[model samples]
Target: MRKQHIKSHPVASLYVENQSWLRGWLYRKVGCTHLAADLVQDTFERLLKRESYGDVEKSGAYLKTTARNLVIDHWRRKALEAAYMEALHIQGEAYHPSPEEQHMHLDLLNRIDQVVQRLPVQTRQVFLRVQLEGWGYAKVAESLGISVSTVKRHLKAALLECCFYCE
Candidate 1:
């Protein structure tokens, strides 16, 4: 039965049905076959890690949305890597880290990115404006139209998230 097939090999069937078009879509967006292929795999891998991924509707829209997020994540990681390398270059060869340290730093950056990405939208906005942009709590609260106490709450939650992930 068709139901039996899906129950037995849900992801494999989904992949067989959607992989080619999804790869094509990614290639059109990123302009690279290799990167597109890589992102396609990443998207499905992300689905497999979900506890109830099998409950996802057998729909193109869901798959497309997942692939789009992977593309956004890929772009973000690339930008982070470029900025990091630029910072290191500015420090000159005399300040260059050992290769192992450099790898560790980049990996840490990626993990931090993941933690930030997991934050809720308002919490992320508060955390970013305060921490990343150096805005005071009142300033960030005014800009976001949230109360200062709310801003502090969000920052506390964000800090707790970071601490939880650090270990």
Candidate 2:
């Protein structure tokens, strides 16, 4: 009966039995209750999705290392996000804009969208290719089977129209 039960049961039960030890191990290493809880949850989540492990004897060791790596990754991502937010905050402080300036920028972007919508099909295609898709003039010209000069002309027309409407 014991053998049959072990065979029928999921490894998830083993994880549940070890959860407290896993949390304690993680907390000791990470020194943060929240971080340890998060890592413990993620470790189990990965275990659930993983395929059959031939050598189940190493589960605990593997889980511990995986939890540590996850903690490292979390710290790295947090640092990157912090740096990005700091940069954005500094830029915001450096370039203070009046409410009118903000409104004007939004208005110009809307008008540019309207102008692009009004353009001829070919002109709109060329503009979207170069500006929105980040394609080079040569690439756009080759793809559309048009001369590079024609590509340039369409781009100029689109820009002029957008600027005229924006102002």
Candidate 3:
């Protein structure tokens, strides 16, 4: 239901009755009063939107289950964000590109991608393996079952096309 409807909701009465208990339970689970308070609020907000709590025989159990799920979701989101930040930290100076530099870099990458897409399939594969993936020409040729000279020819064509855009 909407915010206005929440004031008159049966869940509102439930919230008023059990809010302190719920918050204390959350605090014990999460070990932080501030986060527990926030989760209690979130739990009540979720309860307000439920179509039926009338069938819920044990309201406290239902509230605890919902709050527990919220806590789990909160932890998962925190872990994922931490992993992303850690990856950025590992990139060091590249993590914080200036807006203009970022724009230019993205434009260059897009142009390069477009050029690669226009190449013949074998040429694109050879170029990606040798240039983008840092594979040796000999290794690429071996992997593709082509002669080294054919690999060089495709890479030269790809580089020339890339240079045409660069100029």
On TM-score, the leading prediction is 1
Candidate 2, 50-156: lDDT as tens digits: 78754543468777777887777676556555664565568987776676775565455555666887899989999999998999999999999999999999999
For residue 69, model 3's alpha carbon misses the true position, in angstroms, by 0.3
Q: Candidate 1: where are CA atoms >4 Å away?
A: 1-8, 52-57, 141-151
TM-score of each: 0.78, 0.48, 0.52
| Model 3 bad stretches (over 4 Å) | 1-8, 97-167
* C-alpha root-mean-square deviation, candidate 1: 3.8
Query: Considering TM-score, where higher is better, how would the candidates rank from best to worst?
Result: 1, 3, 2
Greater lDDT among 1 and 3 belongs to 1
Q: Which regions of candidate 2 are displaced past 4 Å?
A: 1-8, 93-167
lDDT per residue as tens, model 3, 59-117: 68889899998898677656655664575568998677676775575566656766887
Cα TM-score of candidate 1: 0.78
User: Model 1: per-residue lDDT, tens digit, 5-63?
Assistant: 76676787788888999999999999999999998998888777877765564787878
